[model samples]
Target: MDLAFTPEQQEFRAEVRSWMEAHVPKAPLKTLEGREGFDEHVAWERELASGNWGMVTWPEAYGGRGLDLIRWLIFEEEYWRAGAPLRANQNGIFLLGPTIMEYGTDEQKAKFLTPMAKGELIWAQAWSEPNAGSDMAAIRSRAVRDGDDYVISGQKTWSSRAAFADWCFGLFRTDPDSKRHKGLSFILLPLDAPGVTIRPIRQLHGETGFAEIFFDEVRVPVANRIAGEGEGWSVAMATAGFERGLMLRSPARFQAVAQRLVALYRQHADTASPDTRAAVLQAWMDAEAYALNTYHVASQVIAGAHIGAEASLNKIFWSELDRSAHRAAMSLLGATAELRTLPGGKGGGEENAWLEGYIFSLSGPIYAGSNEIQRNIIAERLLGLPR
Candidate 1:
């Protein structure tokens, strides 16, 4: 693989770096999990749209710059380097946006993608159910056909961004008799629709970024369904691939954390143990390795190779790397890692960010299919192990 960028790629990176430096918030915004923080981030999304940088890989017709995955990686690198706020519409731009592009009708794309890019609508994932856990094939939520609409009745738990987002997309059992991964349909619905109830779940960190959605005979138009009935398993597998592979968690995200971790170690280096220093170096190297591997994956994707069970490998490595890097940061902070409040009890930015990240990192091994589950996939599919 060619590790060197061409002059044009370098120029594009410079353009992105300049724009991000000029427009990124000088002071960090609040966490996008809170209502105020979520609003602040939505506004940032609109600002990005103004510059036509919302989703650079998307076609220009859909509020994007008509770029490719390589350009998207560059954009993410500069974005984190600029210390930009976390995206409030990640569900829209990353996971659902690509799925919509593949399975949605042109009318659906026209109605959804542009507003999604413009930040007119934010999205949540409604895939996980209380009983189903990580096994999405075990989904039991029902969407029964009724004339021109489908009546949804069930519960979805651990819905990211559903606490304040505008819309959601997930799988539902369209045929009541259908079992496992079969007879499901991918459906979209507004959070404020009638008979819809959202109960926010506060995490251990005291943030209500997730919610449980209860749908009681909620009627949504038939047009909200993506792909054909009973084909949701296939569509959702594609979405899962995105979530597990390159799209959802970019390498630059971890690279930025590694940069911060290095600085953090230096700050407390005098008293730091040699082990901590070694761990820090390992984390940094892991971040760089992830970046190079991602570039390789992007090249293959551009050449028409689809991510498969191999995505499970990517999921395990990055998630564990995230936790390891943040663990090193927490070690550097020691007891003060918990000192998020300033003199007046106001939250501090840099100090607070590390603690917050460490807390968030703890969940990495669990979400987007748990590392344990990913291991099973690797064993059965990749390693040809007997299940």
Candidate 2:
């Protein structure tokens, strides 16, 4: 496949870069985990929606440009290069939105996609329950069919963005007697539903972005179900493919981090260890390599190649690249790495940002089904090895 960008694509990149330069916040908004920060980010999402920049690859009927994946990559590169705010509606735009488009009925698409693209409703991923963190099939949450609705009763932990998100999508046991991945259904419910409760889970950085979502006989319409009654596992695996494979964690993000790491190393090269310098260069090279592979994948996807268990490979590579790049940043920072913000009233800089990145990078191996589970999937499914 040809790797060179067409003139049209280059012009699109220029267009995106210009828009971002004019619209991205002059100063970083507050941390998105806090109530104030969440509000700020939502407003930013609205701003993006105003320009139809919320999710470029989505069709125009859903408030997108109906662009290709290659354009999405170009958009992402421009977004990161401009240091744009993190996507507040990422759970919806990146994971569930794509899944719904593929599995949802026409009515379901009309009801959910427009609002999601407009940022009028934000979504959280309720994938992990107390008993079903990495082992998703161990879910005990049950959603019983009742007339026209499903009465959901269960608890979910480590639910990202639930504290302030408008809705959540997760797997539930629709059949009481079925075990493991069988008899499960993917359901979406509003957070403010009468019997629903949300308790924020503070992270190591003392942020409340993640939450514990409890559903006590929460009644949701059967129409909220994506796919058929017992087809949730398949639908959910499709969602996970998006989360682990391409959309959720774009290679442009690491490419941006690598640029920052190189800048930091240059600032501290006079006193940095040899190992630190070596790591900085390695991070830059890896980021470029990941970006190239992402483009190649996009080309194949355009040619109708579906992302499958190979998503596990993508997840492992990007997660480790993130961790290693951040580790190198911490090494370069030394004691200053502990400071959430810079000293001597220096204001927010790489010193402050590196600490946050370093802390978040630690979780890369754990989220999105965890690197361990991913490896098992690669070995058993991709490599065709015995379980």
Candidate 3:
């Protein structure tokens, strides 16, 4: 299997590299490793949009470069290489943008896609409720149609970024009597609507990226519905597919982490034992494997392949790998890793990064569909196991 790019692809890589070097911020915006509170992160996203780097895979008409998936991969590689800020609107650009392009109406596309690509609109997701997490079909949020609007009433917990978001996209039960996965509708809602409440959940890293959102008779126009009533499961599944696949966890992200791990290893080499050295080497190798697989996925996507259950494998790999890499970093940091906050009068060193990374990595297996669920998918769908 040839893992090389063509001349055109190589040129695209250089172009993206040059653009990233030119436009990537000179200073770190925020250290959002595990913590949240990044208003500047949104500003950085718009900066990328200004540089035409916000959503390179999106169409040119929608303010993107209209690049192929491979080019998008190249862009991601360069972005990470520059140690640039991660896009604050990843949920919108990575998952919802593509789903809307495929299943949204022309009006929906005209309304959401362009601003999304331009980083003008920020979106949050309300998929996982208190009672329903990995089991999305268990969502009880009701959107009763009343004339021209749907009066939504439910509580959404563990909502990522809703506290600072402009809009929200989620699944709602349009039919009270319909069974699981049926009678659901995908709807877009404004966060500022009356009766919509957002309460932040502070993480171990002292950030409020996660939140609990309550909707009390919040009214959303029927025009904001993505797929028609009773078609939400399909729309949601499509979005989830993208979530597990290359769209969310790009291979370039793993590569960037690997480089960081290498630098961390060098920083504390005197303290590293032979066993720790071996572990670091293994992580480097695993990160490379993830990169190669990402390229394979990018090539398949460029060839117009509709990503499938195999994307679950990547999701499981990266999430677990991230967990392991951060764990190793903590181990390597030893006693110094306990301090999570920045040094005030009492000084903390590089270990704070490891502690924050470790805490952040703990969430990986739980979010984006649990690792257990992904394993089940691999067994039932990929391995032909009985449900």
Candidate 4:
């Protein structure tokens, strides 16, 4: 396949780059994990939405540009290149929005999609329970039908963005007697609903990036359910593919990080060790590989092909590359890397950002299905090995 961009695609890239250059915040916005930071990120999301950049891949009726996958990738590249704020509503836009488009009713889409694109409803993923992390089939959360509503009761831990999110999408056991992945329902819940509690879990960097959510007879309308009962496993698997394969961890992010790594290496080349320099080069190469792979996959998607176990391979590749790149950055920073504060009062600069990224990178191997489970998927499904 030809890797070169067509003239039209190149023009599209230029448009994205120019827009981001003009609109990206002059100073980095606060981290989205803190209370104040979450609000700031939300405002930034609104800013992006105002420019119709919030969900370029969504249909125009849903407040998007109705762009194709290739343009979407270009937008992401410019987004990261601009060093824009982290997406405060990524759970809604990346994972849930596409799933809704696929499985939700027209009413559901009309109600959720527009607000989601406008950053009016930030979403969290409540997929993991205390007993269910990698093995999501072990989730014990129950959603019992009560007339026109379902009363949900259970706990979900490690829920990203739950601390300040307005909504959550998750799977629950709808059929009491069914086992494993069967009889499950994908459902959406308002975080402000009665009997719902969110407790923020501080991360290594002392930020509430994840939370534990408890539901005690939380009443949700049947209309909130995404697909039919017992079909959640399939819907959720598709969402997971988006999470692991493309949307959640885009290649543009790594390319930007890799570029920053190279700059950092150049700044310290005289003092840097040979191994660190080599690692920096490797990071750049890995980032380029990921970008190429993503473009190839995007081409296939455009051709109406399904992405399956290959999502697992994508996840493992990017997650490890992220960890390695951050490690090299930390190594290069040496003693200053550990400092959360610089001499000035500034909370986040290049040094602190890398430190924060390193902490967050530690979770890449765990969330969106653990690397262990992903490796198992590669071995059993992709390689056709025995389970």
- lDDT at position 217, candidate 3: 98
Question: Could you tell me how far off, in angstroms, the CA of residue 299 lies in candidate 4 after the best superposition?
Answer: 0.7
Model 3 C-alpha lDDT per residue in residues 1-387, reported as the tens digit of each score:
676788998998888788878877776655532333256778788888888777988888887888888788888888899877767889999999998999899999999998898778888899988888888889999999999999999989887888788999999999999888999999999899999999988876777777899999999999999878999999998898899888898877877887898899999999998888887887788888998888888778777787788988988999888888887787788886787555562332223656766887888888888989999999999999999
TM-score of 2: 0.98
State each model's C-alpha RMSD to the native.
Answer: 1.3, 1.2, 2.3, 1.2
1-387 per-residue lDDT for model 1 (tens digits): 678888999999999999998999887888888888889899999999889889999999999889989999999999998888889989999999999999999999999999998888999999999889877899999999999999999999999999999999999999999999999999999999999999999996888999999999999999999999999999998898889999989999999999999999999999788999999999999999999889999999999998899899899999999999988888888887777764465543434788888888888899888999999999999999999
User: If scored against the real structure, what TM-score would every candidate get?
Assistant: 0.97, 0.98, 0.94, 0.98
Expressed as tens digits, the lDDT of each residue in 37-144 for candidate 2 is: 889999999999988898999999999999999999999999999999888999999999999999999999999999999999999989889989888999999999
Which of candidates 2 and 3 is the stronger one according to TM-score?
2
Task: Determine the backbone clash count of candidate 4.
Answer: 0
Which residue pairs clash in candidate 1?
A: none
Off by over 4 Å in 4: 346-351
lDDT of 4 by residue, 1-387 (tens): 787878998998898888889988888777788888899899989989988888999999998889889889888998999888889989999999999999999999999999999998999999999999888999899999999999999999999999999999999999999999999999999999999999999987888988999999999999999989889999999999999997888899999999999999988898899999999999999999999999999999999998999999999999999999999999999998888876666744333888888888988998889999999999999899998
> What TM-score does structure 1 among the candidates reach?
0.97
**Clashes (N, CA, C under 3 Å) per candidate:** 0, 0, 0, 0
